[model samples]
Target: MKTRNPLPIVRLAVAIAAAIGSCLPLARCAAEPAVRPPNVLVFLVDDLGYMDIGANNPDCFYETPHIDAFADSAMRFTDGYAANPVCSPTRYSLMTGRYPSRVDATNFFSGKRAGKFRPAPLNDKMPLEEMTLAEMLKTKGYATCFAGKWHLGPDEEYYPQNQGFDVNYGGWTRGGPYTGKRYFSPFENPQLQPDSPPGDHLPDRLARDTAQFIDSHRDQPFLACLSFYSVHTPLMGRPDLVEKYEAKASRIVGEEFAREEQVLGDKPRRVRILQKHAVYAAMVEAMDEAVGKVLQQLDDSGVRDNTIVVFTSDNGGLSTSEGSPTSNLPLRGGKGWVYEGGIREPWIIRYPGITQAGAVESTPICSVDLLPTVAASVGYELQHDVDGVDIGPLLHGESLADRDLFWHYPHYSNQGGIPSGAIRHGDFKLIERYEDGRVHLYNLSDDIGEQNDLASEQPEKVDQLRDRLHAWYQRVDAKFLQAKPDGPEPWRP
Candidate 1:
């Protein structure tokens, strides 16, 4: 019950967790009173890249064969994460399981540039007294919808149907698909209408309007969410997938850019460690053919065994900057550099008959742990304290007690990221650098390409993760970077 004011008791805990309709372990629904709860869906791909999928880079050059056959029926997550590295603070910590730096919302919604200081005061939006995980699954009966890029508010009262979404395609307040011919179609997104045709393809017209909103809400519990302003940036594709990735980027070959050590301005930023981008691999195979056209409309509405789904990405992959397109090789710094290739993502999840299919699980989890792990696999509780957990027992293989994952941006990252903050804990991570507090640590099970810094060989694990990342920046009241009135005063804890 420790919410910073949980929207005045969040519709009375969403009418008593929907009048106590319990049992939902992904809709197996225990005793099955004629079963019903699952149908969630989720997708969410912009800027994609935890090695752009082939089940996390089987030499990924960007053809995610239907997200690697839905990551072989989903569990996958070799350390997923994205509670911010870009895109509207990891879509406001995946619609508020909390931690978009509590509320400064860290960065990317009306981004406010500034470097040596000046970015901490940028609220931008996502507030409407905050209850959203599609307004607590619309009082638990679900039927939500929402299609693409909702850059978490700045107008229209806070789009995505005022933050609960009963239906809102192309969620607005700008963040790309910047209208008409932007990704194709006459998509002049005023909540994305013009319903395709006129050169269709805005990720197959938002995956055929989210597979006709999961075949008109398959028979009840829908959530939908689709969110894919394709591989991001105006990097248009689909001229036959840019001529099949320009003949597979003309038979690939080595050395694509290098010089990275400059964390934001003073120049030195190259870093596209080579994923031959032909219009971002034709916008990552037309957003994996719109996620295999919404997983073939959840197997033609047989509800794909009740439907839980949940893929990832909201940040990472725009290798170094706008035209850098895609390459997060060995994962260092990409999208905006809170690095592990800017918040390593592409996690899967599935949940059909309780998860385990291709079950992978390295256990890092984030994106504010997808609203308390799909609102506790659908029974939907979330009464308060959310920094993220309940990985639904790591999708059934089980085990989840250790914790510690943090990030804050404090601005300056139109890519070429600089103001930073990070922490990882278990395999050690650290980071810091908000102008010059200067720290780096690594270890990520032996440097997951953070290029081995270990902050001067682990000075007591960088003062125990910089004192638990400055006590989680005073427990999420974390805004930072400020001087510049005539400048000369960064680094504040």
Candidate 2:
């Protein structure tokens, strides 16, 4: 009659057995590792500012409920950075896990369009030699897909199909569909006649194709890179959505939405205002909805727990047309400069058991780190040299040692910015301008706004940072012009 206590002992044994079962596989795998690859979903937004989402900046013009919720459900990195200050270069570093200058494709391509200020860029594709995170995951038998924008390289020779993605859609437009020729139209504009629209709306099409890819690949481990092109330039928004934002913008302006701007190519004064601020805000809202759809599909497919979802942007928020008047106030310059706003982005990583939700990590992590981090997560070892270290440890609440991060933007930008290179060593940052050979140094911990130029007073600090930047350039074989013949000495401390 007293033998009923077997229930307690039985439960204890079961718990022990379960623990051993989990540990045993990991031990066995370490000896002869079978891949421990988890599904990866990278939701990349374009031209998203540091303060765009409510989780990052509650007072942003647009309300991104989905993005804010996702950030809350994930581990957010406050000091996350993009490799470059501008789009194409930032993306080059993102996909290749190396600096864009290394690839020698740091500028935007114009699809054979020639003009005074614009020069023909080297081929747009991320060279075949570079290994992409998507490609690396394929080694572990993972299904790969890329949706949204792909401004990496030229098509045919360097399309997503060749870059380790099993499926890709709506990614290969030159510059932007809205600004480019008929071939790149945003809507069923002049370009729809021949190539079949990338879809009704660029973001919608990317989202739809992405959902389909997940549905088809749910049975297996997958690496989905869903890069949304919403919020970028050429603000040709969906008509219904445009009307919604038009009312919002009109109320803010205390006037009706300018009909002149809506007339298509009318080039009114209000045209820049509507396209840049109003359409940009609407695009962000659309991108947020698109992300929600993909996340919903993952849940419905029964793979939410086993997937690692990363949300980030290519670069800082675009400060010009199609962007909100949000403040990177303290962050200094916007896109195309060596300031916080241009290169800083919101980074969130969600992995069920491995990472804690609603956590914020202040360690500096950049897009280049994604390669090694994802590689390690998927149980793959990287043999080649990677500029960015694995940030997986930081995401898991480990103490990250101090390290220096550097950036180089060699080309000129149309956004009223000069060529600059910056080096971040701990709390201090040194920015050097190639045009005037000026150095502006700031202790970022004290001045996130970059208001004071301490270089004048701190000669020792300036020399130290300059030495580090030059050494790094030499080590990486970075591309830089040998100061133009007529220009003054471009190298200065």
Which candidate number would show the highest lDDT if scored against the true structure?
A: 1
Say what the RMSD of model 2 is: 7.2
lDDT comparing candidate 2 with the true structure: 0.71
User: What is the per-residue lDDT of model 2 for residues 188-307, given as tens digits with 9 covering 90 to 100?
Assistant: 422122334544556766677788889888888998998877667765556666668768766564322221111112232221112225566677788888888999999898889889
RMSD of 1: 21.5
Clashing pairs in 1: 441-455
Residue runs of model 2 more than 4 Å from their true location after superposition = 1-36, 110-123, 178-199, 247-276, 321-327, 482-493
Candidate 2 Cα deviation (angstroms), residue 90: 1.6
Q: What is the lDDT, from 0 to 100, of the residue 427 in candidate 2?
A: 82
lDDT by candidate, in order shown? 0.83, 0.71
